[model samples]
Target: MLDLWDGQLRDIGYESMGENGISGRRYFQKGRDNRTYHVHVFQVGSPHIERHLAFRDYLRTHPIEAREYGDFKQKLAQEFPYDIGSYIQGKESLVKDIEQRALEWYRDNSKLRRTTQEE
Candidate 1:
């Protein structure tokens, strides 16, 4: 991912930061409604980051689910246009639903090696 970002920055005539020991975590500024906001980027290998990437990949692979999620997000955004702080605040159940479903899928389809032999 850093390599990809390096290529992107080079393409845009920006220099790569070049191994600053920053752990690949980055923060940037964005503007919204005449106010600036800070955004943080999580690195690929970070523990919680994989869950988001996995969920995104799963949605990408499943068009129906992706569309459903997209619609849900749109509706949520519309309903909470001003309450950005509470945006997705109560969606823990939905998140857990996806997590459990994915886990069940992997458990049923993925093969695991036993570390011990039966006596």
Candidate 2:
């Protein structure tokens, strides 16, 4: 998704790149008002987008799980306040568990959707 912050969109100095033996998706990064913004645009219907949305959808329907995940992440960030890699690594197990649940949820919902359409 395209992300814009503060000011008008005009002064974002937007720059984007794709393919050319360099990328599968469009990506952009720019500095405006002393802030740098980076946004990645995934292809529609791509698995990457599906995976992302699936977790979000699962969490949306499960507030307790979402809150636990958020708290875990906050604790990780505190421990690795300046270490991005460590922060990501710390959440690997939780992410995997959540992803499995999300996949199951997607499958169940898709089946229900098809059944409704048939009816």
Candidate 3:
């Protein structure tokens, strides 16, 4: 059986998981409704995972940002509750815009240390 943790599944076999055996990498999966969902879980020091966690932390620390994110998500869900199959299909430009905005926000607000700093 698949086990869910944060944004990653675990304890599944290689075939069920992937060739890499879940060395803390991001992935995607389809639910019972056949809707695609992104999965993310990374080791403590993993750059990608750290960035994601840092963004989450920043949001948590900044209630206004978190509220804004929640409001946007709620509006999106309300507008496309049943459009999962096509929600991201032809919205590459929109996706890019959102990504750029998120990155800029994180860069400006996150307190995560530089990845290259000496430990």
Candidate 4:
């Protein structure tokens, strides 16, 4: 992947293979338009990643929570615009709660969908 990018990306374990219970890597890249993007490349299925995607999808569907998340992110950006780690740390608790809710929602909804489809 890095070779394909031709030095457009700065890889920080984003290419590491998920082996022996290890998770995936996250790649940071700069596009042609000078916009940065973070892409998580996973080798296998992980509950950790599942929860994250679930929370993200949950937020997208839940307007109030999404707004709250956006507001909190905005505040964090204002407080630590250049500190990526701190910005993520500041939202840890909220993210954790959302992760839990999202996992539960995923389980519940998946089961319901299966049942409904079967019927």
Candidate 5:
């Protein structure tokens, strides 16, 4: 899989696995010293896939939370310019909290949809 896109992207981690339910390959597009894009690829049955989707959907539906998250990111970027590790570390706790909330919300919504469809 990485081979297919190897020419276009810099393979940061062909087998870059994350411990926080985020195991997959990672790729990024870098031009000069800036990274323009980042991508993660997971298998079909990976739980991280659902977790990520849930987090994304939850953020989309929750404007205030999303805005807070965006603001935090912007602030972190400014505070840790050129220090990606610290930037990510600063948001680690918030991201974990959001992910927990998102997973719960996602499960509840799924249950509701299933019940509605059965009725």
Candidate 6:
């Protein structure tokens, strides 16, 4: 997986480190020290995969919440211009709340779809 990203990939977390629970491999791509992308890679059957997909799908269906999240991040970026730790710490609570909601919404929608198909 690391080979696939090569040259530009900066691996932050590795499964080899045994960091516990779905932490997987996290890679960041930067240009001139400015981060451009963050990618999370996980093996099959990792529960984190579902959680991430669920949150993403939920955000896709909920435009208002997505916009709010984006705005909040932007605000945090301005507030912590040189402090990545502070920026991430500030968003933790809101991200957790949204992740919970997204999981519930995702599961509920999945059930609905299965039920409708069964009928």
For candidate 4, the per-residue lDDT at 63 reads 92
Which is the better candidate, 3 or 5, if ranked by TM-score? 5
lDDT of 3: 0.52
lDDT of 2 by residue, 1-119 (tens): 43332223336575553432223456555764222675556666656666767888999999999999999988997898778679888999999999999988977998999999999
lDDT of 3 by residue, 13-90 (tens): 111234124455644454533334545545457666645555566666768767866676556666777885454444
Q: Sort by TM-score, best first: what order?
A: 5, 6, 4, 2, 1, 3
- Cα displacement (angstroms), candidate 5, residue 32, comes to 7.0
Whole-model lDDT, model 5 = 0.74
Which regions of candidate 3 are displaced past 4 Å?
1-39, 43-45, 85-119
What's the lDDT for residue 16 in model 1?
A: 46
Each candidate: what lDDT?
A: 0.56, 0.72, 0.52, 0.65, 0.74, 0.74
Least accurate 10 contiguous residues by lDDT in model 2:
1-10
Indicate the TM-score of model 2: 0.69
Give the TM-score of each candidate. 0.51, 0.69, 0.45, 0.70, 0.76, 0.75
Show the lowest summed lDDT stretch of 10 residues, model 1.
110-119
Q: Which residue runs does candidate 4 get wrong by more than 4 Å?
A: 1-22, 29-37
Counted clashes in each candidate structure: 0, 0, 0, 0, 0, 0
Q: What is the lDDT of residue 45 in candidate 3?
A: 72
Q: How many backbone clashes can be found in candidate 3?
A: 0
Which digits, one per residue and each the tens of the lDDT, describe model 6 over residues 42-73?
A: 66677788898898999999999999998999
Candidate 5 per-residue C-alpha lDDT over 36-91 given as tens digits, one digit per residue, 9 for 90 to 100: 44456665676677888899999999999999999999899899989978988999
RMSD in Å for candidate 2, one decimal?
Answer: 6.0
**lDDT at 102, model 3:** 62
